[model samples]
Target: MGCLSATRSKAIHKIDIPALDWPMARFPRYKYPLEDYVHENQQEDAKCLEETEDLIHKYNAAGKPVAAILVEPIQAEGGDNHASPEFFQGLQQIGKRTGAALLIDEVQTGGGPTGKMWCHEHFDLPEAPDIVTFSKKMLTGGYYFKEEFKPPQGYRIYNTWMGDPSKVIMLEEVIRVIQRDRLLENVNESGDILMKGLTTLQNQYPQHINSTRGRGTFIAFDGTNAAKRDSIVNKLKLQGIHSGGCGDKSVRLRPALIFQPHHANIFLNKLETVLSNL
Candidate 1:
């Protein structure tokens, strides 16, 4: 059980089923407009990383030496939480020191949502992770490991049909189109617009929304409260602009890579109308 799987959703895991008892380390909860709180955020990162090391030692003392540390580049389902590159780099060191493999789960933050092919790419890891898993936008569910994690013998891990051939073909074409059309560029462009517009809205309607934060088009802002978040999402849906809520009162925006400036403008305008009405 020390070769752990941190795969459960932070929201509903308690109500679902019994889980292995793995100690949870604190994830850095940063303040909104990250640039404004640089020192505080850095300290938060240090605090969380220190706790992670402490947990590893505690688990080791219990005779269950930690074998792996699984994390997300951006904690999407866990309210889209994010940690600094330094935190992740420090985590990799902890894994090395503790002989635990570093596994990064990218099911939600993958496929160029954060203006990067993988969200961790933004982290600037000194080396590749021990294991990286992908799905959803990837159109296939699979994991790739570093050479060391590969099977020692043939057929140790085997799969004939990876997934539906149709999905594979579509995935290939999707990658091609993304490259040919330079959709990542488009994501950055659109994301800039969206973030700027959202920040303005946050300032303009502080009571309705705040804590606007994100990278590229993977954006989110907090509602005044949970009820207010539900109301805002519902109102946006009524206005023909789809939106979603995650992680308490945070409204997460999962715009496609191809989402253009015009689309961002329309969405922002609709959001403004909703906030104004609220």
Candidate 2:
């Protein structure tokens, strides 16, 4: 299938892969402290959306029409980049006009990591997406699509263990635990604490770090440079906190569903100590 992806700048997930000879549109890059640059960020959104539409038209003109458009609701590996709701709404309209399936890659943001079963639920699209691919926290890789997009015949797509009953059994228990413990609620509560703490740290250490952003516990903050970012991650590991890097210099936080406010506090304190030593 002819496919094209529009992702955020510095997207680590898309690096070093031989991609199809399809188009790549620019994703919006907003200014820090979003409230301070409202007009600028809005313009950024418009520019990116316009570019996306133009690429779809250009690809069609080249005799290789785009059958689908893939995107992440919050570009996780792209430093937790986020776009406004209006931006996603505009994209849906483009997909409708172009008759291209809107395929959302929710592998990184799905299964309650973003305080929602599916991150696109936060976007408020007019209708369900044409396709959604998931894995990672979901315990297995799969795609959900509208009935119209379903293949007419079976075996069109097959895998080694196509009908794995054991995976389903495990997923059932995972679902039960999530619902029984209200993990989504826990994610929200912990996310607030993490976001607030990061914001305060950003304010306090304006020179060392900035651009803290996320939805739920899927959060990140940028370091002053690549070396500083690596240093922070290493130091956090030494302090009994395992963190990772994304994008150019972003320190990402991927906490589990059971993570609570107390856990966030410990993380915040450890992060603060790391920054202080740097």
Candidate 3:
């Protein structure tokens, strides 16, 4: 149906057990801080885009046409890799020209984590993506698509459980609380603190960590190696600050939208302590 990273679908997950054989393309990997490596990162984007176009054309010629191209606003599992707005715009144009739907997977970057309800909003596409799939923090899993992408007949995309209606009620309450408390504003505020703190840490421990980057409460940095990254995560957990690692050596921070500046300060302090110990 759509070409997506194999990393997106857990092998153990039920629905993923019978996945289709779709063409896959490599997502770009950018250097950070993004501002400092703009030229190199732009080149990286161009290279990946070229590869994507080649894959589309090659697959079509082979008579196994790709119906959709799926991508994440931030490649969370693949190391928090991000593409520039221009890169995403070019992708949308390519998808349109090739008659393939562009699907933005916001499973990890949505619900205010990226300072937006949907991370794809930051891309400023000419029009909405053909489809947007979401889960994780949304408290449920589902997808939204344009009318043109709708199934031609009923039951084509139907599921027995569909989804739990009770989950919808809970999600509605969660939405209400988010709006009432203005959690999005809180995420932005805490994100600024986290980013600044991480930058400072990177500067202070250049030999141990580097490449600080993120948006809102979703932040990440690279440890010099996988072993060091695991040690840092384990040490942080012992210090009552749970963190996670991705793409071998990258440590990603997934704080709640309600996380405040003070919480960020606490995390930073604990993180610094762990670094000092290391």
Q: Estimate each model's TM-score.
A: 0.93, 0.93, 0.93
lDDT of 1 by residue, 48-95 (tens): 999999999999999988878888888887677878999999999999
Give lDDT for model 2: 0.88
Which has the greatest lDDT? 2
Please tell me which predicted candidate would have the highest TM-score against the true structure: 1
Candidate 2 error regions (>4 Å): 1-19
Clashes of each: 0, 0, 0
Candidate 1 Cα misplacement greater than 4 A, ranges:
1-5, 8-16, 160-166
After superposing candidate 3 on the true structure, give the runs of residues whose Cα lies further than 4 Å from its correct spot. 1-19, 161-163
Q: lDDT tens digits, residues 1-278, model 3?
A: 22323445343443545556677787888888788888999899899989999999999898989888888999998888878888899899889888888989898997889878898888888899999988888899878889988879988877777777888899899889999999989988999999999999999999889988888888899999999999999999999998889887999999888889999999999999999989
Return the TM-score for candidate 1, rounded to 2 decimals: 0.93
In angstroms, how far off is 118's CA in candidate 1? Answer: 0.7
Summing lDDT over every window of 10 consecutive residues in candidate 1, give the lowest-scoring window.
1-10
Ranking by lDDT: 2, 1, 3
Residue lDDT tens for model 2, 225-275: 989899999999999999989888999999999999999999999999988
State residue 250's C-alpha deviation in candidate 1, in Å: 0.3
Which should have the higher lDDT, number 2 or number 3? 2
